[model samples]
Target: MTDTVADLIARSNRLGADPKNTNYAGGNTSAKGTATDPVTGQEVELLWVKGSGGDLGTLTGSGLAVLRLDRVRALTEVYPGLEQEDAMVAAFDYCLHGKGGAAPSIDTAMHGLVDAAHVDHLHPDAGIALATAADGEALTRDIFGDTVVWVPWRRPGFQLGLDIAAIKAAHPDAIGCILGGHGITAWGDTSAESEQRSLHIIDTAAAWIAEHSRPEPFGPPLPGYGALPPDERRARAAALAPTLRSLASHDRAVVGHFTDSDVVLDFLASSEHPRLAALGTSCPDHFLRTKVKPLVLDLPADAPLEEAAARLQELHAAYREDYQAYYDRHATPDSPAIRGADPLVVLVPGVGMFSYGKDKQTARVAGEFYVNAINVMRGAEGLSTYAPIDEAEKFRIEYWALEEAKLQRMPAPKPLATRIALVTGAASGIGKAIATRLAAEGACVVIADLDADKARAAAAELGSTDVAVGLAADVTDEAAVQAAVDACVLAFGGLDLVVNNAGLSLSKSLLDTTVADWDLQHAVMAKGSFLVSRAAAKVLIAQQLGGDVVYISSKNSVFAGPNNIAYSATKADQAHQVRLLAAELGEHGVKVNGINPDGVVRGSGIFAGGWGAKRAAVYGVPESELGAYYAQRTLLKREVLPEHVANAVFVLCSADLSHTTGLHVPVDAGVAAAFLR
Candidate 1:
């Protein structure tokens, strides 16, 4: 039930950590018991600090490493050499591991050297604004005076510890030390005191920078250079690199510089101050905090900065490409791959840095870091040179297997994933309507018809990119049906839905029906539907995306009409095929449905003439009477369009009717009901 020293240290670290703050790792802290054991009189155990990689936000009781103070002091004496320091650090870490503790941090030596019970370090951009300047030490003295001590940049281990010790010895009243090119280190009797001191130092430095630094002018330029070609722009960029590099080689300088002839020429050509060009950020670390860069556009030589910024979108595309390349190269293997590039920063000719991100949180962080870095470089009299990880290294991270796997595991888009559909007699009429509708709804539609030109035209009208294809074939031929469906899968990605809308109907009584008439009717309607559906189902079943076979049955399937023996019998056979398919494919996620439409008025030249004339003759009435006859039979009294049939097909193809398989949707105007009455 007793609280352990390890528990207290873990609690303190957790209370102080902030995961949202990227710069939190730059700070350090530690805690330990000060009293002796009541019964044994043994010194209470001490907890040494862990450094950077330790996220205090999630620190648990086991995270704290109990280090004997004597051992820590001995390790610090031998930590001057990098290799020796690493070895000693590893050895101490192993010792902690043996004691079931988290590995001790590399910065433990510095923490041990501090005299306070708790220590904290922070590398805030606001604080670094002063630390990165040429006369940063002098500036710190002027601002803080005797409140804090200042230390020059040194390798961060034993040397930093020794420097901190010397500074504290010289200024016994100092609350903390501002380590040059690094961050601030503060200490106190407790974690709160250390945290407050660190915050005070950052706030003080931020105030000083604000008071001393003048805001750089941004906005439109009068006018300057006009547009230039890519080659010339590249040459100009090369020409300016040396100057840019010279300006970048200062402390705390993360600079990005670019020269564009178009921007430069535009400003020069215009009446604006065309001589000024833009600058960008130089470091990736800056990108994590401030984004990439700013845009500096060239206005007329006499133009104001404000006007140039207003028209600054010209460079957006190029900046996005560069940002994408940087992200592609530098992203961690565990990070998501860039689908496309984004504009994180923009450079305007004659203007200062401008940072951007998709949201305010990212934008604010980027702006703070970028503006501070620009100030540090400008105050230092030049930009500091910093190298980012190379493209190859970045690519390795971007394409890491874990990230790829994570992305691949996401669910695919529905209604189109590997589903293929074929429309017969698609050159005109209900076939064309069905083909167009299927393609629009994401199914790959294959238009097969006797007219090659009409099939191709229908495919083009469907707006199917590559999913809708045209084939000139008589659907009745088994060989042609096989080839057509094969091509459908290849073109549309897969085969799943078959709208058996191709059919020919001839009116003939049993006495008048000849052998040729019977064969031809059966061939196109019964034979064609069977062949195409069979071929499609094979592929659909193989794909396992659930296959649908939709037979375009006529109202004749449910009614007996005069002089319609051959046509009526073929349609009945087609309807029966749907029932059989449903029974067979029910377990495979495939459904079979039929649309029994009374009359479809839309088709090619053939339907408007031959079929239309035949229907008129069969009804013993004018062709115009066809619509009224069908509408009068239905309950809704609505004239059925080809789209009505197409809509029914869509419902059958979807999962909404998954449980209602082997059914028929009467697209007719209640004609079956009229017949029953």
Candidate 2:
């Protein structure tokens, strides 16, 4: 890449990475440069702008759309009026010289039409504060004098780009302008100059707001609205997430994220929160993620837990009704259908914010955007009044055809998408494989294991915290088991699937088995499975969302294998627990099942923990041939691996077995003796 293009990427990263500058996937950056045309071997002036759906912080050369500047600018000749501006987006594809790098965004016109080497259109909270102020035009002049101008509100399209170009051409010394009720746009002769100007504008605006702002932008905290103690608040948040998730998923199932950050707590406590929140967010990017407004749980910090939950239900129902009304008020004959009635954001006075989306990252980003909106509210309230774009205007952008197309273009979700699972003893072997597979199928997973570090490492291997989180828990201990369940709720809202995979084996003959050996095997496999299931059941039951619980039993549960008294007994205990729990939990829409796999020695924790040698010795086979010996005995004569068991778990928990419960699926490569009768 040329230095100019590289600099633009670096500058975009610098600005986009910071939440103060722009939200995830919001805003665009551009660089104008010369590139040798492969067709003509002639130098051509091209515009490299951040592509549609690309985040500035992680932008790459490949994420930028390359267009001939001459063709881009020539569109002004056939520029339709504001009503027909959307048509211009399609016209951009015709401007591409040779193979374009990425799809062009609507903001392309704003960067291409402007006469500058580098341009930045950012949605910095501080700059947007001035942009969304009631008297934004007047505030712009007062804040930056004539160096920065103000342009009236116009929907982002060719018309807005033309308006900005006109403003820049008319004012020779102007460095940038606040796009009224939207964001700020700046340009410079060089890449460094443009970045410097953008930062200066944002920082200067923030300083001005801080200097001339009210002592309490959100107004003083109301009585009983202060944040609860950290432990209490988080505990409350964890307890409340499942129900909130249930309410939000009325239209479709969604993963959730919870935050008790100072900003969220402070906003919830403010006297002005109700009114300002009702007015909703100003930025299109902000509202698109957060929705028009958040659903506030109108209860104090000390309210009874049951009372608080009841109030949340009422609040959610009311929010849905109001949202439907809002959609009805503005939807035209050709407008996109109402996407969902459930609010994306939920606010609790003493707790924090709960944001839900199709996945964890999207939910987390939605919460981040709401925080940005709160900052904008603080600044706008200090300047004049927090005047966001009107309801009609917001509805227009929310239901825009282009946005609908973007949603439609999203890839199909995986089979386990939106499901949250917890796998016990998932640090390695079969448990880890199960967690990895679950995450790959789009379910957020918690790697719960006695080995804390390995659990964390296993979670990391899956992906970011949004996809998997690791926690330490000894299922034999009730408190530790409960803590693990709470942590899972705190991490990704709630649990939908539970895998009782934590176990150890002791292959001792009946005469040789000690009391300690019997207790150890039974405690880890049987008792531990019971504890995990009971704790996770509370959350799933509270969610009122049907869930799955799978027990990783053994082929020995059914098969009578000699010299394995303690291990075989414990596996049999686990197998029965699955049937018992399935019968009991079925009333609550919870499915319980089991996977019986034989001689999974390759990656079996059981085999690795001295059981392999003991069992191999009893069978008169070398340890290296134990798997093959077991495989040869089975009808299929195939060695069952950890992944085979993981696949069985996935199938049991997936929608494919929605109607089948209390069933034992064997992963022992056809152990007919171990098969359910």
Best by lDDT: 2
TM-score on alpha carbons, each prediction: 0.42, 0.99
Error of 1 at 321 (Å): 34
> Cα lDDT of model 2 overall?
0.92
- Tell me the tens digit of each residue's lDDT in model 1 across 1-677: 12544544554454445421224333556754444545577765565565334545555555556565555666655565743443555556533423535556556766766776777665565555555555777877888998887787654556567678677767878889777755678877766676677778877876766666643322232333434355544433332322222222212112222323232333323332222122333222353344334434434323443344234434444555676766765676556646444433333333222333322233334545554444344333222222222344334433444335545755664454335578888888788888877777766677999888889888888764444678888887888887676555334334567888887766657898899999998999888888887777666564445668889897888788777889889888988888898898888778888888877665434347566667668777677677666577678788888888888988888768767778878887677442422
Point out where model 1 deviates above 4 Å.
1-414, 604-609, 673-677
Per-residue CA lDDT of model 2 for 1-677, tens digit only, reads 89888999999999999877888899999999998998899999999999999999999999999999999999999988888888999999999977888999999999999989999999999999999999988988998999999998888989888999999999999999999888999999998899889988999999999999988889998999999999999989888888999999999999989999999999889999999999999889999999999998878887988999999898888898999999999999999989999989999898999998999999999999999999999999988899998999999999999889889999999999999999999999999999999999999999999989989999999999999999899999999999999999888888999999998887778999999999999899899999999999999899988999999998889999898889999999999999999999999899999999888889877688898998899999999999999999989899999998889899888887899899988888887777777
Clashes of each: 81, 0
